[model samples]
Each structure stands twice: as C-alpha cells, then as structure tokens.
Target: MLIDWFTVAAQALNFLILVWLLKRFLYKPILNALDAREKRIAAELADADAKKAEARQERDEFQRKNEEIDQQRAALLTKSEEDATVERQRLLNEARKESDDLRTKWQEALRSEHQSLSEELTRRTREEVFAIARKTLADLATTNLEEQMTDAFIRRLHKLDSAERGELESAFKAASTPAIVRSTFDLPSAQRSAIEGVVKDVLAIETHVQFETAPDLVSGIELSANGHKVAWSIGNYLASLQKHVDDLLNVPPKAATKAIAPPEQQANG
Candidate 1:
C-alpha cells in the first residue's frame, strides 16, 4: 500500500499511447467497414421496398382488367340472347303467314272446283230434258198435233192486243221482204190459206207471206216480219222450267232460253 507516483505516471502514459494507436489503426478501420456494410444494406432494403410497390401496382391493374373482362363477357352474352329471341320471333311470323296463305289458296281452289262441277251438272240436265221432250213429242200423232198448232196460232193472232196489232201492222208495212211463217212441220194448204187470211186481216195490210219448216221450233209456230217475231213453243215452257231448276241449284242465269230471239227480233205476245 506504499504510494509510488513515478511508476504510476509511467504506466498511465503507456496505457494512453496504446489507446491512441488502437483508435487510429484498428477501431477507425473497423468502424469505416461497418458504416460501408450498413449503407449497402440500406440501399438493398430501399430496392426491395420499391420492387414490392411495383408488384402491388401490377396486381391491382391485373385485378381491374379481370373485372372489365368479366363485364364485357356478360354484355356479349346478353346481346346474343336478345338477338336469338328476335330471330326466333321473325321465323315464327314468317311461318304463320305462309300457313295462312296456303290455307286461303286451298279454299279458293276448292270453291272454283265446286262451281265448275255445278255448272257441268246443270248443262247435262238441260240437254237430257231437251232430248226427252223431243222424243215424247215425236211419238205423239203428228197430223192431229199439226192441226191443233195451226188453230192455236190463228187464235193467237185474233187475240192480239192493240199494241201487238199496231206493232205487227207497222212491221208488215215497213218490211221489204215477205213475212216468214216457220213451223216444226209443213202447213197443209188449207191451214196455210187460213193463216195468211188472218195475218192480212189483223195487220190491215196486203202482205206477201212465205212458209218455212224449222224443226228446232219444237212443236211451235212463229211469224216474223222485218225484225219482229211472235211465237208459241214447248221450248219456251221448257226454258221457264229450267230457270226454276237453275235457281234451286244456286246457278247463275245464262242465255239458255233460245225459244225466242231478243226483244228487238221477237215479241213475247
């Protein structure tokens, strides 16, 4: 424990020199190395942070793009569905119109055929009736029928009204050709003379008369002067009967009555 100041001072000086040498050589170089390492690590850390931010931005962009793609897909699907519906409706309308047109055409065809059949039936019936009437009349006594017809014709002339008498008188006076008297059979000389005498008396004129046989007269007698004619025929009666039949069959009227010429050529009287 004895105090020694000189030894203590010397040992203190050696300790200070050793400390300065270590600070200048070892500690300063080690500190500089540590600082360089820390700077490198900080730079690496900053780079990693920047990379992470870029990755986040890319992810966000990708997510937004995915959402936009989904919306576009949905819109396309909806449009496709609407278009399909419109097309289907158009096709259905076309089909319906075609069906209606076809049905109408078929109905028209059927109606036309029905009318044609009705007309044919009416024609056949008329021909058969005419044939039957001709046969029946032919089978009757020819001489008696002729005599009766002549008497009837003479009676008709006598029974003529004022208008009928006047028309015949005028026609006889104006006619350049002889009056024609037609019948289904030839008139006997006596009947012919009687008819001529009556015609002259009724017309009150001297008129030449010509006689002609017309088989189509069908048990009838006709007197024609100029364009005027008067007749009584079974054909007229048959024509009236045919009119009734045509009405019953719902047939349209035709120029089927040939028993008399037009009013300009014949008088009903």
Candidate 2:
C-alpha cells in the first residue's frame, strides 16, 4: 500500500528489455528458419507434381500405343479372312469348270464310239450280203451254164443294129492280132457253133475266137476293143456303192436321235 515509483519504473523497464532480447534472439531466428523450410517444401512439392504429371502423360501415351496396335491387329485379321474366302470361292469355281469340261469330253467320246460302232456294223452287213451273193453265184456255176451263156451272147449279137454290125465288121478287119475273150464257164460244141454263127453274121469275115475261164471276173460281160478292155459286172456296182459310201462319210451331219415311243400306262379303274 506504500507508493514505490522507482522500483515500479525499474521493474517495467527491465521487463521491456527482456522481451526485446527474447524477440530478437529466439522469435526472429525461429521464424526465419521456419520460412526457409516452408519455401524448400513448396519447391519439392512442385517438383513432385511435375514428375507425377510426366508419369501420367507417359501412361496415357502407352495406353494409346496399345489401342493402335490392337486396331492394326484386328484389321490384319479381317483382311486375311477376306483373302481366304476369296481363294476358297475361286478354287470352287475352278473345280466346277473342270468338272463341266470333263463331262463335255466324256459325252463327245461316247458319241464318237457309238457312231464308229454303227458305221462298222453297216459295213459288216454290206460285206456279208456281198459274200452270200458270191457264194450263191458259185453254186450256180453248172456245166449247162456255158451253153446258156453262149446262147445269151449269141442272142445279143442278133439284136445288134446295122450300124453296130458294121462297126463290129470294121473292128474285126482292123485287128491284126487275135483277141482272147474271158469266160467263167466251160464251152460246149453247140455253144461254140452258135457263137461262131453269130460272129460270122456280125463281122462278115472268118476269124478265130478263143475263150478263157477266170473266176475273178465277178459275173459280168467283158469285151476287149482296140487294146481297151470294157467291163460291166456286179463288182462295178459294188465299186460305185463304195464311192457313194465314201462321199457320205466325208462330211457328217449332226446326229439325230430317233424318238422312242413311251409305254402306255394302263388306266386304273
């Protein structure tokens, strides 16, 4: 309760000085260290952020590369599938074409074989007919055949016109060499006499006529005139027939198939 101004003033002054000293030494140094530490932490944080951002960008770029690779793989697979489908279709078409060509060739071969068989059959039939005709003719070659042939030849001489008779006489007169006549049968005395009479009537000159038998003549009349032999026979007819066959075979027309009549189906009551 006593008034102490000097002590009070000194105490206040001492307190103010201690406060200033503590502020200068402790507060200022601590504040300065804290500020520097905060600045360093901020710089480190910024650096870390930049590194994270770079890592994120790298990850995005890797993901984008993977997506592009996947797309390219899908495109390649699709293209390969298309190419395989095209190849398969092309092979199928080629096989079908080959089958068609083979079928056509087979049909042509069958047609040719059938035609050849038919022609061979026709040729054999003709040959058989000619053989039978020749066989029958061989059986008819009797002793009386010579007499009949001579009578027939003499009959032809009588039917000759005046112009033919004069030509015969001229031919006989012009012939200095004797001509041998071919025959297929034996000559009889009556036939020879008949032939002599006809020859004398046609030529009006006496001449010696000889006869020969040759089986190769093929049933016909043959005469030699002025070193030229003229013949009319079944063999000549056959030769003409063979010529006609050759002409028919040279240009063959399209084969026409004959229609086969269908069997009638019985009506059910």
RMSD of 2: 11.4
Q: What are the per-residue Cα lDDT tens digits for candidate 1 across 1-269?
A: 67688889998999999999999999999999999999999999999999999999999999999999999999999999999999999999999999999989999999899778756654565456645655655676433556667888888889999999899889888999999999877889988999999888887889889999986565579999988987766667666766786665554344335333488545653
TM-score of each: 0.44, 0.39
CA RMSD, predictions in order: 13.0, 11.4
Clash totals, every prediction: 0, 0
- Candidate 2 minimal-lDDT segment of 10 residues: 254-263
**Candidate 2, residues 208-248: lDDT per residue as tens digits?**
76666665455544445455443334455656766676666
lDDT, candidate 1, at 248: 57
Please list the residue runs of candidate 2 whose C-alpha ends up more than 4 Å from where it truly belongs after superposition: 1-25, 112-269
Which portions of model 1 miss their true places by more than 4 Å?
1-21, 120-269
Cα deviation of 216 in candidate 1 (Å)? 18
